[model samples]
Target chain A: MTRPALAQLVAVLVRPAAARELSLADWDLLVRVARVASLEGRLQATIEDAGMLPDVPPAPRRHLHAARVLADRQHAMVRWEVARIHEALAPEAIPVMLLKGAAYVMAGLPSAPGRQFSDVDILVPQARIQEAEQHLFVQGWVCEGYDAYDQRYYRQWMHELPPLTHMRRKSVLDVHHTILPPTARLHPDPALLWKAAVPLDGFPGMYVPGPADMVLHSATHLFHDGELENGLRDLADLDALLRHFAADDPHFWEHLTARSFEMDLARPLYYALRYGNELLQIPVPDSAFRALAVARPASPLRGLMDGLFRRGLKPHHWSCDGRLSGAARWLLYVRSHYLRMPLHLLAPHLMRKAIKDHRKAKREKSEP
Target chain B: MIAHEDLKARLRDAGLAIQVGPFVVRLRSQLDRIERSVALFYDRQLLPVDGAPFADFHVTLARSSGLRTVWRPQARFFLDGRSPFRPLPLAHAYPLFEWGLNWCIAQHAHDYLMVHAAVLERDGRALVMPGEPGSGKSTLTAALALSGWRLLSDEFALLSLETGKLVALPRPVSLKNAAIDLIRERHPRAIIGPASHDTSKGTVAHLKPPDSSIDRMHQQAGPAWLVFPRFSAGGSDRLQPLDRAEALLKLVGSSFNYSVVGGAGFEAAANLIEQSECLTLEYADLDASLGLLNAVAGGPA
Candidate 1:
């Protein structure tokens, strides 16, 4: 069974009044969920509303306030970085399309409020990505050290260039040509995403992905990537985006399913629909249910994926983790690497990482 | 609050849950040495169980035993079931916990403008000493805490955003190297913990905080004085006024979250410097330094 506390916390997040009252024990578990999921700052509005009633206490309120402050600071830093990136990319005329947290904040989406932004992401056209990188270099953004092997790997197989950091500010910028890596089975055309980009009014030369693409990108990043460290937070983002877009567009669900098919992202969309509805109770339209029925895995594979994702998406709390969770995470990790690279490259990379990690642990344990 | 004997028993069993200034620490250990330190140091703060399983940082301290036990047996600290750093010798267990507490604060408490400084209150005024390690901030704070001044904190100076004041977080003062002997000789009756030599920072011991400071822990002080202290042997005692802008920059540089707090940090810092008198003090003798401090506090020397 899903942890009862996890279920209650998710329910309360979706519909705040669902929590009639909570004991100190419940608040304790919620604190861990909020912290590990990085939702403390994002849940400020709900906390403020909840605090007005008798359900909240001073200790929990303090924790919520702390998170809200961090979110506010993060939002400020993101805005500052956007201005600098726009200055750098403006000269190249590279129609910057912000992705993820940067996009949510720029577009003034509900998901942006109190969101923790770690780094800024931008999308440029594939043809001019090199020129864009050169322009950023002149503006003091230097790419991280990539050896001959890594340089070849990224140039030939990756969708985005290696991440770059500013010399003075030390802020990170991830420039992308497409949402998914080129090595992936799904080959999404960048032109379609660019053509549908919505420009922000005040911020000239900057745009965010169109409504359907935004949700699809979130789904692909969460499910396809190698790391599930922030899986729960990413799921929360998908849930919020789906709900927001549905409210804005009457045909959002239909359009999203069609977009998924055209972009060759049906697998991630199916997973998103199934879990978003099951976990966060996002309103799934008839189109989504019908699409999931056709696109989802068959019975045995479906049962296995169900087991993996259900455990994988919850925050890493001991109370919620079962014996199977560790193995599930490991399997998912290997699966991501397999999906990320061909078997030849994948075998060596995993072996190297294992040996390096083992040596580091042993060295640390033996230190004075 | 739980009785001291009960608290020790709980530590031997499940763990001892204690609240230390805005954070709940759940500590578990089987070592008798760690238990004695717990009884001597954290006796006042352990909370009675209220049937809640809440803790911000869960850590375990265990003494290593084996062939290596004869020569420098060590104490290992674990947080969230992971060890971030190497073990210290067993005699360093008490300081290990102190440093661990600071680590947890630095990692999680991003809500406040945390400055690496010593803060103490006298005459309803706060004295903030922002300095680097081995800069006499801790030693000066210990002397002040023992001499009738209410100690706010010897390590972290938490600047609150909502109230726009300094929150008090008093703990045992850590004395290092020559300062350890200085405090022991000067105070005479000082409760100095057993010293552990050859630490990364040299020999270190802790001075137990005066009981009155712990009793008045809830009191937050308004900003009044900003003192940047540096101790030099055979040096003259001097406290010179510093420019407001310069003080703001130094405070920002010393802060843990000044950049993270964005505009709020800049504004709060400017407000603090504007209301307080900023000075830089250099001294060799503790008596001379305390006299200058009293003069600044409007007391006859």
Candidate 2:
């Protein structure tokens, strides 16, 4: 079947349309015009009342309704799950704070209502991750599989533990070893998370990451990899954070930058702020941003480094389509490896991982 | 001075400039006709709107005719929803929309190999089982996720392709008929949603993803084995290997839209099915089968 670009157009436009009010005829025309964009000829209107101006608003009511409905559902799920997590982890339990979508939900933005959460995110001490895993396992948490090779990469080589899944529940937990990948040379310590943790009322043992840390996590998570897919949502979160917490302290940027430097995530923090300001119209004072800017990569070399960094955040397919060369790929791979492990141990560690992945693949094949 | 119209009023007041595709739809003077046309395209009754401003964020709801009822993005879900969202949500009403949206925006970004499978992980590894309804996928998924393995999803298992993180969206594990009784008999503490009856499909009930799964919901998993499970009443207990092409096609078919993701989707699907050992399990015995899965999942660790 010849692929339908119409579907893509629809996917892109439908959401926009829902954002505003369009009479049936307007929507119909909008779709038609989009389809005919390539046509060299002038377009013709088919409606009888073409001359009459459509009273439809710029955006549709349905779009907002849909966004709100999804957002509300997301909030309820986050609220319910966060509360449940607090209850289950108990009083002596590790402090867990909501990250990304969960944080946005608590921040009380209308965007929170539409923000979709595929899985709930929380931060726990790297040491307690195993304990957390076991605790969750006994309580019906099932680990989704990774072979010995894959397992080693996550446990010993990478920053986080392999994601833990539940058999009965449709949720997955991303138990992190470090907030930033080990290779990024950034470690937003879990202890920092605990120190700044804010308690949810009535949930004696439960806590969310403090405001500063929460905002940092949001920036880091959104900007760590390129914030392509959820860019708008990230912008919304930054907007929310700026409006909510910044109001209390005009020096929120100081706390934010200090924490980023403390964690060595200033580069990612810079990128997030830059893109947020550029795309979402978030306002970061030039002076504040200047202090945190990642040192410029060498000219000519900078373009390569930028692409490499973006690729690291992108899907493998993106790298391929975007034309990441083998040499560049290898360099980027090396960077990722370094980010994942201590600088001293990265080489041999990655070599071991490559061998292990091969062995694991062979083992899986022999099984069935 | 003229008062600004409310959002609803604008729609009532605005003239239509109709266009569905290349052809412009004839604008109707009456509001009744516009509502009917919008409804006709929207299979499910619900329409979520942002009410002005962005205008592009609107989504129409649609449900799968077969197996479980999932509220999918009207355009994308039908093509992909059936294979990916099995045992579907108990009903397309609210929960489905809520859970489905999260699966799309947040979890899918990482190439986490989003599977229409339920996950149960123990030790550190997880077993991802993707399948269609009546395949006994959920019953087995529910049993394993609740038993010991972390419940990745009774509905959708989010596996990251990059970090190989299997993110869990443990909402409600939906069960039909005997499976509901089976789970109740097995785990008395299980919380279940109300059973919806005489649905165009069948009598359906939702088992809440175990409380702990909900509590520790952000668990990321690396996929070790990809199993397409089928629960037959008297079938032999065997986990057979599925070929890569077959496995990929089956997975893509089972996906909400293997096509939508295009090449990246293709690569993600290929990478996952390629790396993991593939299995098609058919069995009548739940307990014995779960034992097999546990052994398979827990073997090396």
Candidate 3:
């Protein structure tokens, strides 16, 4: 509960200028924690924005500078990949809605800088999803080797198709027809997102979700998704998105709150705003919290959820971990699956994964 | 600097922090083989700090846990409590540590434009020899390091991005296969570590770099020559001029983080080639190659 290193890391991230006052030893721990949390690039970007690069000590500066370089290169690659995706899908007249990191970067959002992600996620109409996949295949994007069960699980129950990797470039692209899985407890209509999508300038047939949808989708991906390894990074993304969008529009919070209720995603929105304010101290209006009162969990459950998320969201590093950090992360992982699917389907899927992992470990141990 | 006895004691208990060029690596090992190897090769660079508060890398060479310990004991290389490589045989602990350190630098140290080359310096000018495996690059590096040129690195040529200078990361030169015996014979005083056969790189041994190279580890040298060496069985000892543009492309292709560093990487490589005499050296013999390199360094042939 009392992680001084995590506290210091958060302080530096929220206000990078404070890095000027940090001791050499703090920089050492900060670099390690930031690297583990995948926030090194974000830290570098913020520090540079504050013009604190020259003031930082040489040893730590090299790491930050290196991360910035990597982030820039990754951003450029994402831009190029988006262009290629547009090229492949444009021929079919299918609209390519850029999602998450790729969307942030192409749309020139403030959340884009220093952000690195592995896959390019795109959304198309559910009716034309197959048609879009055909075009992508012709353009050298083939589905990665997912097992029969996983392939079936994705096609039948999941929102997105199994990830397609470009054969030559080795870049992954996730094609989705909706935001959440069909079996998930909440289904924010993909139609609403597509309707509100804004076209990207200079890129034909490519669009990014509207500001409210961007924040909602990021919040959903972070709080609803099973893997929280990059939990803190995703939270940071949410923080940046909210700050940027709120400043750009006078009624941004109102639009976000209304959209969350309109599309069955108020819970994630509520949690996002709550954590953004709690963890990163991003300002949220009292009216907005009052508006999402229906989505808030009961007092006892809410307290437990907060404890789990608070521990789960920190960088999964030993330096940042509490006594129950591992347990909290594991419980949240199970909770995510519970939210995504019915118990019958979830039980079998998890059991299969556990068995397969055990066999894999056994096989490895038997190797000479 | 810490004493050898102190270093060994620390290696067995907490860890021994040693300065390797620009980075401080804290090494720990319970195995006697690793302890002996560290005492032999890294005796000069051991810091007096009892467990350095801030290390660029924290690496451990420890015996692999589980059943492998009883039948075929193996050693694993861990960086920050996670092993990036599979466990090698217990006898191969020293070589594993060396390879592991190279992996750590190549993977994380994006501050510099890292080239897959051996670099040496003389008269304040660096000679970077970029070559593919089995090109006799390490063998040539060993020859030059013994013949008075201060060894910068045998694996990576750390090119500083801010300043177009070669930062010295002088460590033990890794010699493989026949080059081990070759270097041992050529330089009788050279302290070569115990060779571990059947490695992925074949038989591998590390030659302890001379004291002068370690002493001037902080010294940065302007890149004066870029030589791409290709070893042939009976090829002519020729040092022919290579086009700068072609050399730039080759350097980019041979770099570890060229694409990661992006535009800055391209500019750095181009600037290095532009400032240096770019050449392709093809030689069959070590002595003849050394003669040609010395001539290029403007030393007495």
Candidate 4:
């Protein structure tokens, strides 16, 4: 009864071989679990195996059907976006790289099939990011940034431009120069990422990170994320990427570990490897497992993180969210902020954000 | 299955699970008014096993926590255990629940192409009236439901993407402002709920479907007529045939999930247009309009 439904979802997904044997106690709880973990769409994609959903009854089947429809819609939408983004930036000739879900789709990886993308993320060379933004604006992808502070916040400190959305289509596009904010302690070299990028087959100007770098980016994005709203999904994506790249290259793990160190991202990678194996039951090479030990947070921090992450990463729902998970999420939220920027810059940013939220809330309340 | 008094008691005590359209919805609330309102509006609904699956949406209407409850006294809506929006006044809890259910369907239900329209059937053929606010869509639908037409839905016309048929989702028709009084006056026997004033959509109330419509809730209808009802105070009744291309364009605009449902939406919209003779209706006279709609549906005119 105390078993976390998130673990059960991941178990079914990553270890489908054992899924046929597992008896479901509450299909109702599992639906919430899948939604909270952002695995509803992924579950339908995962349940394509011949015997995957044989035990699931009708109610749960209905929920899964909705999820499948959503995934299909997202998949089609993502493809259309890539083509649109390509048309906008083609004249600039700036080597634009598709990131995350778009990259997964472009590469046709296992993770691509049912991945739901909120926004199209593209990496342009740092020097040309502004030029790329103007090109996009001309092509109708304009920023809806309402405030001076928000515009300044992104332009001054953040890694990406203010999110630009198509006027007609309304699909959001996030233009990024690097993975992390400039104000963060660890700013991965834009040149290094571009150097490792590989062009997509049919998309002429579009590219995706080389296999190892893609895994590293996924790990970095997940671990460093302020909110792990889709924590389980990201971990699942990493699991898929590791399994996928491992097929063609024996040294995929070796390169991933080395690249994490090279980019000063060993900390995130350590968490990714530990939780990826723990929650998802993904196979981690013994040598790679031992290699990450040096990179794990030292002693007291490691103990604190273990408790925080175990609760925080799981779905924040009645099925799994312990009373302590709320506190854990807050602590982790603060921890993410701490990692996002140095203390000098963090205070003002937090204050500005709080004020903006308060004013916005007031405006909404006053509306008829 | 729990009925009126028992369902209200259960909803007050624990929660109530009921089949709504193609999905099961479980709603929890401690408000006494919620119990009374639900009993009245959803009296005909079929209750499922308590705390069971097949619930596409789980919602709760509880008193807002903290000082706001002490001051203004509000009821907050929680969906899938998360409160997506802020609280509404306690008096408007019933209308809030109706709006919340509509939100649940509009947001999550993607298996069908959900059009923001009123749907009713007569003679095995469905009539779709896709309209914006102040278009007399719900009022016209309310009038028809009381007359002889089998009410499918007063909110959504759920077009099955696979079969191109309209699924019946019979629920109370939401009547706002003067229309509530109009419906009450016209249909004297209509099961109208109490009015909720000063909602986001102005004063609103729900009018329950007739017993006959409730009885045929499971019945499905084939697409036949699309009427875009436009209400005006002095406008004479008129029904002009709309071009297929323009009709499809208007339907796509009225659809809640046309963009998200993608190719399925396209196919369903195309199929609906092909099957139905579309029209733009401008009317002030109920009898005249009803006559026109009946004639178009090939029902007894």
Instruction: Summing lDDT over every window of 10 consecutive residues in candidate 4 chain A, give the lowest-scoring window.
Output: A17-26
TM-score of 4: 0.94
Q: Write the per-residue lDDT of candidate 3 for residues B140-236, one digit (tens) a residue.
A: 9999999899999998999998898999997889999999998888789999989889988999999999999999999999999999999889878
lDDT tens digits by residue: candidate 2, B1-301: 1122332233344322222111111221223322333333211212223222122212223433433223331112211112235323323333333344444433223233455776766765667778787889878878876776677667566655446466665555668778888888889987665565654446667775655665565556566788888777777788788887998888877665343334556777777776688888877898778777877775521
lDDT of each: 0.81, 0.55, 0.88, 0.83
Error of 4 at A157 (Å): 2.7
Q: Judge the docking of candidate 1 as incorrect, acceptable, medium or high.
A: medium
Best by lDDT: 3
Clashes of 1: 0
| Top-TM-score candidate index | 3
Q: Which stretches of candidate 3 lie above 4 Å from their native place?
A: A358-368, B12-14, B50-53
Please state every model's RMSD to the true fold in angstroms: 2.9, 21.7, 2.0, 2.4
Please give each candidate's TM-score: 0.93, 0.45, 0.96, 0.94
lDDT tens readout by residue for model 4, B1-301:
3656677666766468766777777888888888888777776675755345346677899999887579789899998778888788999998888888889888778878999999998888899999998898988899888888899999899998877899988788999998898888887888898999988789999898887877777777899999999987797999999999999999999999898888779999999999999999998988898888888777676
Q: What is residue A155's positional error in candidate 4, in angstroms?
A: 2.8
lDDT for model 2 comes to: 0.55
